[model samples]
Target chain A: MKKTLVILFVIIGFNAFSQTANQILLNTYNKFSKVKTFKNKVHVDFNIPSINIDTITGKSYYKAPLKFKFKFKGIAFLPKDNPFLIYNFIKDSTKYIAVLNGTEKVQKQNCIIINVIPKEEGDVMMAKFWINPNTNCPLKMQITSKSNGVILIENFYGKYANLCLPDKTIFTIDMKKFKVPKMVSADINSKSTKSKDSSTKTIGTIIFNFSNYIVNTVINDKIFTDK
Target chain B: MWQLTKIELFKIFSKPRSYIGFSAVTAIAIVIQIALYADGKSYWDFLIQSLDESFQIENLTFNGNMVCFILLQALIVQMPLLVALVSGDAISGEAAAGTIRSLLTKPVSRSKILWAKLLANEIYTFLLVLWLGILAWVVSLAIFGSGDLVVLKSDSLTIIRGADSAWRFIAAFGIAFLSLSVVVTLALLLSVFSENSIAPIIITMSVIILFTIIGTFDLPVFNQLKPFLFTTHMIIWRNLFDNPLPTEQIFVSIGVLVLHIVLFLAITFYHFKRKDITQ
Candidate 1:
């Protein structure tokens, strides 16, 4: 009778800790979703080791519920979907299972690590978030997707700590594993006769430094539409 | 010899057909420039789609050097036809007009007249290429302005600075001239076997088209045979744009093209020297 009681208490303790971890994740998601809109002056730097590409800069405007506009002075390349999609996924608990893995220190701050597994079949297979326990903000996120490979993002929060906004975001991508159309790759291969081996294994990194961010600004929806 | 060449040049320039090549080149260049100017952004987007996820390229200008490179790639394929039009008619046209008999009746040897005709044809080929350069490269600079040249190949994207690009263009054009020389020689050799000017022109074009098809066919048998085709060497000019230019391969391609030209000219000389004019 004594042994049975001890085992039951241990099981209850494990369940209670798991519930507390889920509650913490929910709080962090709510804090990030509070920002309605923002406009930022951004400078993007790219470092592609295999293919020599220089750094680039641009301006970004973002609104709540998936509105993002990026304008560059000249030719620019970006992913098809907005970067903020990760945040949107976190805010909604219906489509994903978020579990608290453990705790770690990021930049001398104690952080709670959460592993998010999508419920429905999608491009993103898994996403791991490292959240600062004090501010309920994300310090780093590593997303592994089915088509685009792995994307590791590290966020730096400065004076916008209260608003839960990042001053800089660094993205490192595994380009070789990214799923592009076979036709595009074939076309490029046919024309290029050099560096055939190196191009297939390229890894690229992009750093975005955000400045003069105006949070909760009223932005027209027309600005996000393609001209 | 100079007088014979001059007469050949005069005969070539007097015909209205000579201007056709120049006019075609100019029109094609202008049309392409206009098209690119109007809808270049969509083309740019299509090209950079693979790199879009990683890089944010900005301030990339569609400058004259880049335009010239594009024009050269598009125009090189049609240049053989232009070369064949004039050189193919050099001997056969004279035969059709009964001028060969009159010219052979003179004290000069048949080989000398052949050499003069070949020299005149070479000069004409040079002028045609120069005119193409003026319209495609020089005029494009006037319109689009000068900047770094961006060359997109199947596997690589190369950007050549404005200061460094001129010498590469010069080398490319020189290599292009050598390639065209092979076409001219082949046409001239074909001209010797026919009495009708149209027949030689058509035959030369047919041979080029056939060879090009064989060279570009992506089959094991064709790939093995491609090295023997003179048409395969014609695109050796593209090597100029490659970083750390493959000097040995470029030289080999040049050697092959030159060998083809020499063989064609030698065969023409051997047959012409032995043929009886009276028959």
Candidate 2:
């Protein structure tokens, strides 16, 4: 009878362990939902072969759901959950239809591969992703846009374990042909990498340091409702 | 000389294309200002938030009104290019248009005609700069209301009071005009080498872009070269936004830019006079 009881408890414990992974993710996401306001610092580094662009240090603030503000030095670029992004996503949702490519392990985490045909026809090519089964996160994002062309964004899970956020994200993009407006005021000029030729074979690296991780801080009431 | 200059000025203002650049300036400024205004709160919050991390202080308020400041910031970088578009063409376009030969028939020396064109271009550039100042400052304040001018640079944030903004703009505009005049001179010099006005404009702008890219390379080689670049001087107008205005560096930038103008004009005059205009 004792042996039977032990076997039942073991089976129950394995089932509970398997269930906790999804449960933990849901809880973390729920905590995120409860977070009304918080602030964090970001150090953005662009790596190009020939350019040693200056490091941009900035702060980011979010007030739930759709509002995200990024202040770099003193100028600001805000990308929020406006209708534009939502509408574009909704409209392009059909375009994201993918043909099964193949499977590969991204940072030892298994991911499904799919090729996407971008709804908007341009130099940029598109690829799609369905999350890896082991880690319920974005497995792959690839674009074929040249200059504004195809880029691939893939996330690895090893860095921030149980963080519910993708740990290591890599963006593979073609820089030589990327075309942005000459006058769009962003840090474009400051982020170019140096080119290496026969005369110069040296590659340069820039390290960005970020600290002071404050989470779930109380925010002013007006910030969320002001705009 | 005065009569010749008046004639040249007349020719410039009468052309329909002269107004296109101005229209573009106003249209672009208005579009961007409106876009920024519609999306300002989040923008301001982002700026403030970025500043919040490096800065220990709390409740940092932009003493300057947001709209006016954004207008000025936009103008500072772009005005020079717009000014260059017209000013660069004043000499080269005249040459390309085959009007230089008729103008030269007035018994005035080629050098004198060149000088008149240069003077006319400077006046036109100054006027454009003034227009930008008025449109950016007066119109912006009218639309957005008056406050302090807060300028954010890579390393620091500058705050200028509402009362002091006008004079600072005047100084800034002066510097901007002077910097563009150098581009004008460079384009005119390129004009002497080529009959195609568009080619000179393209070449001049390319040179400016190349130099600007080089200036930002942040290499030991570029560090020495940065001080000499006219593009470096172009932004010196921003010093007025600085609380303790870096006057020495501003003057030095102005002097170097003026020297470049002199050198370019001299070269253009020499080349224009020596070239056989038989074609």
Candidate 3:
């Protein structure tokens, strides 16, 4: 009778552990997937020797899978591309969620890993998320997009709480993809050819840190619409 | 002394050629305005669209904002040449015309005559600049209609609110006048050395263009010399666009300009006093 009781106890403990792990993965992803609903500040750093842009600052805000806004301070947008700070490019039939290949690693006392890929080919290419195994919360993410290029984002440095959102976050850009359309203009192109051997490039750097972010706050609807 | 100077001033203004500078300013302002109006939207839209992916901006109301700023942008590189056309030729043109000989024969010292010419040229320059401010900014705003001022720098876009732009425009022109005056004064000094009006005008413009190229080249040699170049000081007007005034740099520019004025005027007077006037 005692042996039978031990076997039943072992089975229940195994089931509980399985449920917890799945719950942690799902909860962390859900919180991160809702990124567009929050107000956050981001810092973009870029360097390109060809066109000579080193670094600059810009802010990002999002409404959902379809609508997003980016505001670059002191930088003007070129005419060929869309210039809205918040862009809504999601189509009606587009998928919003997908499970990507996951990688595992131990961070401090907690073990966590994540895998994610874009639902569309034209959307951001790769996004890797790091979740705390014990707390079931996402702690950081590394993202790369074809449009803006590579970006690194991490939550505010603090102990992760179970199934809770980050209080503060920081976003950074890799600078390779930050391009100005005017750099490709005919005037610059001709000048480039003339001084093909003489031109020397300067690199610029910019860094930004975000604090006191409030998620699910009331954002104006007009921010997403065209004038 | 003042009376004689006033007569010379009157003579300069009474000539139809004096009005040419003002007329040219008006003509250029109108041409640029028309060109901007025709394609201003597309130009603005193109700029906004380029970085839209990074910064998803929406509902940027043009309402003549971008056009007003474009006018100012054009002036930064163009207005000094206009200033040189008149102020640079003040003494040189008179010498080339053989009018200086007749005027010098009057009951006046060479120094006094030089002062009169300088004063007259300065007055003309100030008036021309004021006229330009009115036509380029005020009249254009009226014709184009008032709105925000959208400024485009290398990597950023700055918007000055419409309500804030009026005073900003006034301040910008005020700073622009000070800068142009320095150019005018330098041209006046050059005019003293040349026999032909065109030569002084051309030389002054060449000097400015050369310095502008040097300032922008990013060479280690130029980086050291940039602070000393008058062209570097010429763009002091642009600093007013910053949220807070860059007072120290502005003061430095003022000091540099004042020093140039004094040095140029001193040289002009010394040269004029000893000049044989035989030619």
Candidate 4:
């Protein structure tokens, strides 16, 4: 009878732990969703070993339900979809199978790791999030996609920790893995032998530094429209 | 030879058809510049949509340098037709006008006359490219102002600083002139075969169109054949924008183009030299 009681208690404890991990993810998502509008100054640094480029600085405006506009003076190279993917995933939590992968230290802070597998087939095949247990914020995220390969993003929080907004985000992408069909690659095929050799070893990284975040600011939808 | 070439140039410039190339270039450049000035932001946004999520661009100006690059891309394809219009008619048009017989009756050898015509065609090709450069690059700069040049290729995006891009444009135009010379020579060769100006022009354009199609077609069969096509080498001007600037490849492309020019010239010379003008 005592053995049977212990077994029941153990099962309850396991279920409780599972629920706690899921609750943490929900809390993080909820915290991030609260900011309806935000305007911030951003500085971008592209660290591409194969190419040379200067730092790009710009102003970015974001509105809830996916309206984003960036105003800049110079050319900037960036991944088009991953930022939205991160926001979309957090906004719609029901589409993913989130499971606790246990605890780990992220940036020397204790965090709970969650393995998220998409329920429906989409661009994102799977994603892993390292959530700061105390603040219920994502410290780091690794997303794997069929088309875009793997994207690793590290988030650095500042005064807006409570709001789940990062002051900076660093994105790393393996450029060599990105397959561009010959039809689309401009005139690279004119020097195909040389280009083929160099493309295999290239890696691209982009860093976003955000400041002066004015949250809940009124921004017109027309500003986001392509002019 | 110099006197003969001079006479040929005078004859070419005297014709009203010679002005068409210059007019077309200017019209196209102005139209494109105006359109870009009016609605370029929306067009650029669509192009950069894929990269927008990660990078925030700033101070993205549409200046003369950018316009020049765009003009080159849009106009290079059409430039061959302009070249063919004059060059394809070099011999055939003379024949059709009954001037070839009188010219052959002179003390000058057929080979020397052919050289003079080719030399005159080369000078015309050089002037046409220079006119395109002055109008497209220099005039656009005057209108739009100067800024960095951003080039978007299939697999990569290259941004060249405003100050550094001038030399690249010069080199690109130089290479473009060489490629156009190949077209001129090809047309002249075809001109040797016919007495009608229209036939040579049509034949030159047809050959170029066919080769370009074969060069661009993604089929496995076409892939092997692409390396051999002069049309494939024609776009090597774009290579100057590549980060490392594939020097060897550019040289090879130039070598191949020069080879095509030589071959075309040789055949035209051979056919003209042995021809019976009396018949």
Q: Which one wins on lDDT?
A: 4
Residue ranges of candidate 2 with Cα displaced over 4 Å: A1-227, B50-66
Error of 4 at B259 (Å): 0.5
Grade the docking of candidate 2. incorrect
For model 4, chain A alone compared with the true chain A gives a TM-score of 0.82
- Model 1 Cα lDDT, one tens digit per residue, A118-224: 89999889999899888988899889987677888888999787767889888877764233342432321122243546446566677788889899989888878
> Which residue ranges in model 3 land beyond 4 Å of their true spot?
A1-22, A28-111, A117-126, A133-136, A143-151, A157-167, A174-227, B1-6, B44-50, B58-69, B92-113, B139-175, B193-229, B235-253, B276-279
DockQ agreement of candidate 2 with the native complex: 0.02
lDDT of each: 0.79, 0.59, 0.60, 0.81
What is the DockQ score of candidate 1, to 2 decimals? 0.15
How well does each candidate reproduce the native contacts, as fnat?
0.22, 0.01, 0.03, 0.35
Among these predictions, the greatest DockQ belongs to 4
Measured with DockQ on alpha carbons, how good is candidate 3?
A: 0.09
The deviation in Å at residue B71 for candidate 3 is 3.3
Candidate 4: deviation at residue B101, Å?
2.8
